[model samples]
Target: MVCDALDLDNEEAEEEMYKLTRSFVNPHRNFEIPTTNQVFKMETGKNDVSLFPGQIVTVQIMPEVIQVSKKAIPVHIPISSPIRIILHPMFHQMTYSKAVQYLKDKSNGSYVVKPTPKGFGYIAITYIVEKDKAGVSVGLRLEVEGCKYIYSDLGELIVQYVEPKARRAEDLMAHAKFKSSVENLNSLEMNPNHSSYGFCFDYEMP
Candidate 1:
């Protein structure tokens, strides 16, 4: 007599097999279970992790789990494998001159965040300090050191001082009113009727 069907008689084994087969068929339906090796790799900065909205993952912060609510760029942080930073909507990739020109006609305090053209991981805050005047605009270098953002030009700690505190660039922008020369840039979605509509552009991650 053959014994191939013997295991099928066990209810627990049958249920487990069914679940495995279903997970294989629908990979997305399967829970995200990072292997020990995967966690090690992420901790060592050897790999990057991708996370989707509403997905929960276990992290090394006292071994706790967190759920993401929106799409974000995976940024490596010391305490976590892949932390997310929501870049401001006004963030763009433009040269200093272009950024200055974009803010030239706008009111003072109008600003935009752009990547420092010199290198990666460095950001610049280009704003119109004085409208309709020579040297009307200025670009301040913003650096992310570990979890804190350093604004060397301001000489004050960027992480502190901001009301309610700000962890990321987007948060800082929300607390501070650095209006965009291109109207509607403050909103999540663009509005067609805002002035300088042509300057509104989508932010492309570098």
Candidate 2:
């Protein structure tokens, strides 16, 4: 029975589109910046990237430890698997490619980085808009997959200086801003004014 169910489930998920995320608030509202961490320690004694919970970022799969043992034949293996790290890369136009290079370089030329057969790769590459507002970078932030390059600024999840304690009002406003981003993504998928990707975020509304 289990094997039969597995086959049926696979058949059901064969379709390209996910089951049209169903939610009353809208799918975009649910988009949260996935939890993230800094890829490397920086001079400032902090990790570089920042990601909110739920946002998605692609982390390359590379062989971390390559050991040449005393044995006649030394074997090397990767510590991690191909996965999208729930973090951000430094923003760059060719950030996707750079990311691939990072893995290639880090792995000492063990793996070749390329796009997965699935249209969407291990990582989801969605447009992240960070704008200057009142002397701060404020805009939509999420960890998604798609780029095959290493992002320098635009795409990477960067770590900024921690802000001093915000006043009650500031904190409230900050929370609202994040909520808005989620709402907007949900809205775009639902409305999808421009159908560039050949898929409409719209759903059959009852």
Candidate 3:
């Protein structure tokens, strides 16, 4: 008798789920997962200095062996994340150490525009915009490679340090829109589209 009751309860639960998902069962819709980029307000310089078109930057994560190389210079980065490669047309391809040395030369050792890694497929690309005895700060972009469509890693370049801030009404509205969209998707039992224009319940039952 107890087993029969449990089976009935399970069936009821599944029926409730199907009813909840009825509105989202669209054959043409595809669900999109949220990328990490949505978590941060990405910032950068007005005149960016990243690689030019058709150029690829090399990122290095395990920086131990690189320490012994003459081309590599140790940069005191406060962030312990995945390294990235930011390049220019002038620098098509280079080793991780080489990229660090290149930046060290440009900044006169004051800053380091180097890439760090956050393994698990996330990258920490940074441009060292400020340096001092107090602390070193860098503008960063976090994302995995080849997934720019799913997640665009907007590397930061500079930010305001000392200033009284006011919450802008426009910013608040934009944030509210994101929250509303998320809630709508969840309530509808649907996934958002890649373009964020639609939602779908595309899961298959085993």
Candidate 4:
């Protein structure tokens, strides 16, 4: 029964059957990054890169270690398999190379395309948005394949720092200003002409 299903009698038939079966399953599963100190470490302390808006950065993949032998010798390997670039909630149905080119053209180079090395010779690239309000670099934050990590350029592990406590004062001031403005606006008598207009934020709406 096994031979009939796998077609052991004919090598050509077996190859065809394998391909047919593979079509049903996704070839590229999601890849995640390792973050433990025992598993990885950052290679550099330099954590800032000035990336402009609409700029696309293409990063090369680095080789990574998979396992350590009983003799305490680490085994390193180069990535050989293909990778898929994740865009939205779902993974794109294309290779990383094609996806990178497609995104570069689609966004007119408004995205950062930096591929980092995951352990075991698997590399995954992450997309970063460089906006005016979000330009603070806290190392390379990756959340691909439902995994997150902060790593150096060489793919070693690192820690991600939260926004400084100093920003709290500025945040409080901004909130106070917004509250004051709303309170002052609420005290104003509604202009009958302006209230009759189709303004979406009309405070005179009963």
Candidate 5:
């Protein structure tokens, strides 16, 4: 029987493989799983196996010997750049309240992108909508889908205001409208007096 051929006792192997695949797909993850490819040399005191693209192999995880070499391995996979709503010299790990406070006195249209405190691969874009006697700040939720960023109705409303035909968040990033807006916002001098002026936020799920 097929079940007889399988080594059911070694369940960690399957989990390790899944982790490896996840790490390959998203390099930003905290842990890494080694592959039998040239990019990762397996020093398991056995004959090394060469793997071609799209090839599959059963990996046996040796927890004791699973150590990556000090040599750097060049990853050929194309990873997307972090979504930066505004170009500012700030730390990418600030809280939501701090982010709001940073933009409290800024002019309308000023914005900041930060990782959502709720996590789960979601991000928040906080921007100033009204900067009159009473300032108004709006936070929009954005999700990372593979290499692209996407948002729902609220994001659509803002994107449509700049580009009526825009669909994906990448569209807004590439559009001249938002590019100009980012440049204008970046050009504005940051208020050094503000306590949270140098703090920002960015995060990736593992």
Candidate 6:
């Protein structure tokens, strides 16, 4: 008797699910998803460093060994995750320590420094002057060998990890527009030669 009652309950439940799905697909129904003209926005109350063309913004050297397969696409690893520990026959144990140390020694606090992971050292500076936005943009050119510099006409370069502090209504809207543009560039497939349209550094996926 209990088994029969359970079967009857299951059938009723399935019928209820089917009705719910049909209601969702009905064109006359309305959903509650919010719509926005804006796409991305910088965190409020952060400071901004005004950089200009030909200006240099120096940073500390940090290196990580990225693995590349047959096609040469960089194998991405999360920044929070520990690097893979490996042991090769020739070298009993291997870690990224050696690579990091090498770069640090080479940099030695130099303003003109090469980017780690090798061959990602070119810099591109751009000025954004759109009607809706205005700012200076800085980026790294990742598609060539050796070190080189280029100029662009894009808007401000907003680093995702950094906090931005611009409270003016115009600034907020412009920043939001700039953020969306950067995201669109970052979404493209890796192109070392002319990838200056987006961010040069790899980021940890949340």
Clashing pairs in model 6?
46-164, 46-165, 128-154, 128-155, 142-192, 143-192, 143-193
- Compared with the true structure, what per-residue lDDT tens digits does model 2 show for residues 116-175? 334333322222112211112222232223332233433233222112212332454355
Model 1 Cα lDDT, one tens digit per residue, 4-122: 11122233554544454334235485334443333211111111243322222212312224555898889987683332232557666677788887877776445666656454545
What are the per-residue Cα lDDT tens digits for candidate 4 across 107-147?
A: 21122333333332333432322111111222334332235
Q: How far is candidate 1 from the true structure (C-alpha RMSD, Å)?
A: 30.2
- Residue 198 in candidate 3, Cα distance off native in Å: 58
**Model 4 — TM-score against the truth?**
0.17
The C-alpha lDDT values of all candidates are: 0.41, 0.29, 0.31, 0.33, 0.42, 0.29
Candidate 4 or 2, higher lDDT: 4
* lDDT of each residue in 51-135, candidate 3, tens digit only: 3322221111221222344687798979764434446333223334565555554432223223333233332322222221111
Q: How far is each candidate from the true structure, as Cα RMSD in Å?
A: 30.2, 42.6, 44.7, 37.2, 31.0, 40.3
Segments in model 5 whose C-alpha atoms lie over 4 Å from true places: 1-91, 131-206
Instruction: Please list the residue runs of candidate 3 whose C-alpha ends up more than 4 Å from where it truly belongs after superposition.
Output: 1-95, 108-120, 126-206
- The order by descending TM-score is 1, 5, 3, 4, 2, 6
Clashing pairs in 3: 51-87, 81-117, 82-116, 82-117, 82-118, 83-115, 83-116, 83-117, 84-115, 84-116
Assess candidate 1 and give its lDDT.
0.41
- Tell me model 5's lDDT, rounded to 2 decimals: 0.42
lDDT of 3 at 135: 18
Show the colliding residue pairs in model 1: none
- The clash tally of candidate 1 reads 0
Q: What is the TM-score of each candidate against the true structure?
A: 0.26, 0.12, 0.18, 0.17, 0.24, 0.12
